[model samples]
Target: MTATIPLGSRISGERLAVLLGEWRRRGSRHGSTDLAAAVEMYVLDGQLPIGTRLPAERELAAALGVSRTLIGAALDRLREDGIVASRQGAGSWIAGTGARRRDLEIPVTDGIFDLAKAAPSALPGLTAAADAARHDLAAYVTGNGYVTGGLPSLRSRIAERYTARGLPTTEEQVMITGGAYSAFVLCLRMLAGPGDRVLVEQPTYPNALDALRAAHALPVPVALDPGEGWDLAGVEAALRQASPRFAYLMADFQNPTGHRLDAEQRERLGGLLARTRTPVVIDESLVELDYDSDPLDGPPPLASFAGELSLTLGSASKSHWGGLRLGWIRASADLLDRLLSSRFAVDLGAPVFEQLVLAAMLEPAGYAALAQRRQDFRGRRDALAAALGHYCPDWTFTMPSGGLSLWCRLPKPMSTRLAVSAANHGVQLAPGSRFGVHGGMERWLRVPFALPSEHLSEAVRRLSLAVASVRSCAGVPAVNVPVA
Candidate 1:
């Protein structure tokens, strides 16, 4: 029931509906033609890259809350204009033979089954914390809103957590930013400039790749096999050959592929980076979400080995709530001072209210809620793994002990096409290609279990339907890759 991979990227009907906001002309009679023309505008505007696959008509109709006939008529118009192409068995795609896959750098709309992000909803008692924070805010109201680095109290709380984990730290070693992404940008702007090589994992965070590109820094990648682990020899080679200005590595629960470096590996990698004198950015946003063991007992932070050479990025986005938009950086005191001095050029400081809210959430007394969150996430992870086993028996993925996603190795390289079909079937996906440096990991996909167990189960059921659609669309012979 699976198909070979397709070259193009896919968009879910729900995501597309969000992108095509207010596409219909008010009081217009010809809805189908108008719909076709709107899609043309998206193509022309480059929202829908060439070779992008469209969802099945039924899916689009459901997403748009329109009749299936309208969707069919719109497709008819699009096909006549050469805006779309389709065969009887193969599903429709944006008209073109081949096009480099384009990831729409956009947010997911609510109500659709969104698996594009690994973010879960706010932790329980967020409202009560905000209420507590309101009382705390009273102390700061008399003074001006801006604070350098971050609120001292929040930094202290974060430092305590880092110390608990293994990285002993004082408040001086940490600086807060708007979010982890902003923290990365602040470090990027500080270190390397245009054309400097930056080392990263092959299928690292997509937005991190986007940030690297935006800064005009060249990203040198080291491939990561989800089943296997980091190839330290290859990393050593890249450090030598690439001579990257700075390297970005996720030692704890690395994104996409939820691979964590064990204590031995961490010591080895830390020693390697320290020897090379290569500065690294260790993203620890998902470090706190480890389900199997206590976060306090996790391996020592990569920075522990690399010393001042490593700048660890911490975030509340995953561990707490993303809406708070609070994350921190841990570096050597000297480096933290330097980053703090230069941060104003980017923005003044993080918000006071959210900082207070997060600080409240992190208080030592709140472990019950935090423990409950991990328990819940672990349950959802198992549910998703079970759903895949039940619905798409051929599809394979390594079960992530912590973090939010399962990095799936498809039965075929149908990641891109499956994404589009999955969208049509009411599930949005983080396609495999979005993660690669050059956009071609068509055989893999990252499915997040951030939703509730029920949602995850239903989402996989829908994914099975999409998988069937993709299989039916494979006109070319399947390219066989060895499976374990």
Candidate 2:
């Protein structure tokens, strides 16, 4: 005989208890499917938000009057459907929505050590900076305390740092905002509007693309050639063809691909950019995190070449910690003045505490701490590369000397499928298509080795299994590809 499962607790606690007792007697065979169904009913009824944390396993099992083993099975099934996620110690949360339509469960697993996000948390000395910011707060407590225009001291410090980096900047040429994305939004608002063309790399950051859409700008994609790093020739061609009014470039330690434009290319691109009169928005977020090359000493800043035509955005997120939402834009003095006046319409400014903290981090000692972090990241990158080389030979990848991720090009165009398969094995990966312009990077995958060495090795092992799975399904003849 079939058994009826209570939909939710809405029927009253007594009725739920009675119903649970009835279902418990039906045994495991009937209870498992019923439990998953009940969870689905809760989601459909809007009882849980995407990313809502669920109760503890013991508590949930007790409440449902079911064994923990049964609850785990139900959760496993939900996870297969992408309905929920359970971190080993971090508890489970409802996965977010996706473009593809499927019954929601938990989300894709980023690696136990997630290489997806390039940024890390604050290093060891951040507590001292936080303490300093607390002191700074005492003087500002009497004022409005809203940091819409940013703390003056921070603006000056950022400008000074820009000057130190070879790009002459002044306090008037800077404006502090939240992170890089927030800074980009503020600039896009001031520079472009609906129907305006903005050029971006083909395999660009997804959130930035979303921001462009939010700004109502038409996005024109310039493809990045995995073989030659970013396609300089394509960039030039796109400039002439698209005639976009604004553009964004990460010339140093670019995100997915980890490619940096050399001095000559920067110079050539800068001249070409000037002729187009398109304001280039350069994300120098990862500039300080480089690992493969010699420490940057005297090369001209990417913005130096762009001259008045550039707006350079920097952030402490990657160099410091993602938790610190501090980012600044360095532009021509006049542009900075204009942006400052226009910015009030969106946000008052970054939080005063964060500005104070970042300002403290900008000091010489703070930079030394960051240097240590860079060295650590370098070791992790090398370790990840070694793991990949040892396990997955058919896949080709470029070793980004400094950035957080390795942009790997696989032998087959199965990045999306591989991401799905990887989730089944407990490793979440950012698909190559996520980076491509208008969905083009099907053969590429971005992997980061930013986690601890042990997690990096495990992630690589899972990735190799995933690649093998993808290859087996593709049924293509195996061909060797070079990966550094």
RMSD per prediction, one decimal? 15.4, 18.7
Q: Flag regions of model 2 displaced more than 4 Å.
A: 1-111, 292-298, 472-484
Decoy 2 TM-score against native: 0.74
Question: What TM-score would each prediction reach against the true structure?
Answer: 0.77, 0.74
Off by over 4 Å in 1: 1-110, 474-484
Against the true structure, whose lDDT is highest?
1
Q: For candidate 2, write residues 1-484 as lDDT tens digits.
A: 2222211111223333433444433556877777765554333222332334566777777777678998888788777766666667666665522224232222444434455565566676899999988998899989888866678898998888777767777887887889888899988998899988788876677777778888878776655655565666656766776678888888887777888888888888888888778789998888888665433463567777776979989888878887888888888878877888898888877888888898898888998897888888888888888898888877778777777888887766666667766766777666664564334355678887668777888988987787777765642121111111
lDDT of 2: 0.71
